[model samples]
Target: MVPDDLLLETRDLTKDFGGFLAVKHVDLRVRRGAIHALIGPNGAGKTTVFNLLTRFLSPTSGSIWFEGRDITRARPAQVARQGVVRSFQISAVFPSLTALENIRVALQRARGGTFRFWRSDRVLEGLDGRALSLLADVGLEDQRDVAAVELPYGQKRALELATTLALEPSLLLLDEPTQGMGHEDVGRVAELIRRAAAGRTVLMVEHNLPVVAGLCDTITVLQRGSILAEGSYAEVSRDPRVLEAYIGAQA
Candidate 1:
């Protein structure tokens, strides 16, 4: 079971691009082995928060604690090595490489062996099994040999998750898994995400509220740059402010 105490925490997190605040003094607590969703309109600083957690952007005046480690100013690679890794909202994969090879490359990178050309041309130790298992886990076992670019949009996203899984991160940060997908494709991908959430800690920034309601046990809604509401789907969705700020858009 996932720990109830927070696996990732931020104390008054803030970010500034010059004088403008992209993310305000926000605080977040994500528990271990649970699925948590972050939702907001465009330009609400969801991506900015991701950058801070991954060490892609340093927080302006906040401290980030992850799995009990203070990584407020850690390097990107260091963050990944410490078991917090992120996947993009858009596809981030090698277009020309096969799904199997994509995961193989990530496995090598996770172990810091991708650059060791001096070793024989053989793949990293045990990577074949790991890559195969990852591909199978994402339900792409049959497509393992297909070039990543040859697959449809949804498959590309699955490939991205497979690559991220090869890194063996304890915490997974997903930008948006359902973006640019058709109804059937969205359902398929949602199930894929469900599989991923079983034993992994997930923090996702998603725009689709219905999807969030169906999948997430807890939801955080942001407006402008800070949280507007947080709770279960029914609790937050029924709030008058949430309805005014969000539901009015679709209705």
Candidate 2:
């Protein structure tokens, strides 16, 4: 039985790619309204776990439960509709669309799982207020009129975050939300994530340990596709196995 406070759980999750075991016997638990992080060196299968959770890739064995429902075999769209929305490791945005428009597109999809491109502008305008609010939530309000391509790299990522939030996900899955970001941009985006995490659960795969240390309430370290350590940042950082395998001398 899943605890009332747990929002997502995976039991003995494994993924086999031909003869390669990308992920093996992984158990992940994400508590409701907490910021959790998956961190590891390359080839640790952090992304693979995210794919399995969202059904982008099927696990060879094991089951995934979200909100107490088994979703091991749920379709990608079905998982998304269940309020599990993921942001990719790369910045994904409509280049030509303004920040507000990008968010509006997500809002439209969230409404009925279809983009009503044929709908009259006036009809779609109803979503503008909500879209603008989402943009503001991610600190993109000032870029509302700027095309995604015109925004700086950090703002582009922020816009992507805004769009993801527009879906009203109960569990937000962020894949390297700060990848390729400058120092300043990292801090900004981190702050945005902290603010956006209010009242919702966040599960992120992040490489920047500082960002993980600052933002995540619980940290799960992976090594060779299996969990190495799971605890608060301070606890995991001090774990001898975690330090030797993943953190090296950094801890």
Candidate 3:
């Protein structure tokens, strides 16, 4: 069980695009070292919430606290520097580069340098070694030299994970990390995500209910830009409103 002390909390979080409200007032929390799943139908304000967290879209009027700091108005880079980062559904990898090279670039970005010493092959090798170790940790060491674009679909996803892990984030915001894959691939990615969940908090927006049931300690259901229900899988699944909006035969 995750401790009650929060790692992320959104108080009346909201987002408006010109006059249309993309996301309504939202109150959410993610605890340290917990796999919290956010599930909802298409256009259910899931992505909007992620954008707000990452500061991609400024909230209209609300507060966002991360690791106990108010960051509702932080810039995207500022938020990333604070260890709040998200993984994209589409691979954000450098497809032209080898897996090791991709991770090397991310490592330098994480540590805040890559172009400092031009002639130091030793430093480059050190960076390569660290990237290799991280790739190995993500079970992608065998493909270290393989170009990211040439990898299979699942492998591309894995590469994306490696790049994100290189950021060493305190909280991971994953948007459909297992989207566009087969059942076997889904299970594999789920396992990989579980492996990556050590020592950090993870929050995901997933439509796969089985994945949510298998991995989430708590699930929040959203509909029409508001949280419809939230609780244990069984608890929320049994709620009449959730059933009607997202859990019944139609759901």
By how many angstroms RMSD does model 2 differ from the true structure? 2.0
Write model 2 residue lDDT over 1-251, tens digit each, in one string.
34888999999999999989999999999999999999998999999999999999999999999999999999999999889999999899999989888998888876663656676677768899999888777777888899899998888898998898888899999999999999999999999889889999999999999999999999999999999999999999899999898878344
Predictions in order: lDDT:
0.86, 0.91, 0.86
Candidate 1: list runs displaced more than 4 Å: 1-4, 249-251
Instruction: Please give the distance, in angstroms, between residue 245's alpha carbon in candidate 2 and its true position after superposition.
Output: 0.4
Q: Estimate each model's TM-score.
A: 0.93, 0.94, 0.93
Candidate with maximal lDDT: 2
Report per-prediction Cα RMSD to one decimal.
Answer: 2.2, 2.0, 2.1
Pick by lDDT: 1 or 3, better one:
3
Count of clashing residue pairs in every prediction: 0, 0, 0
lDDT of 1 at 12: 93
Q: List the residue pairs that clash in candidate 2.
A: none
Q: How far in Å is the alpha carbon of 118 misplaced in model 3?
A: 5.4
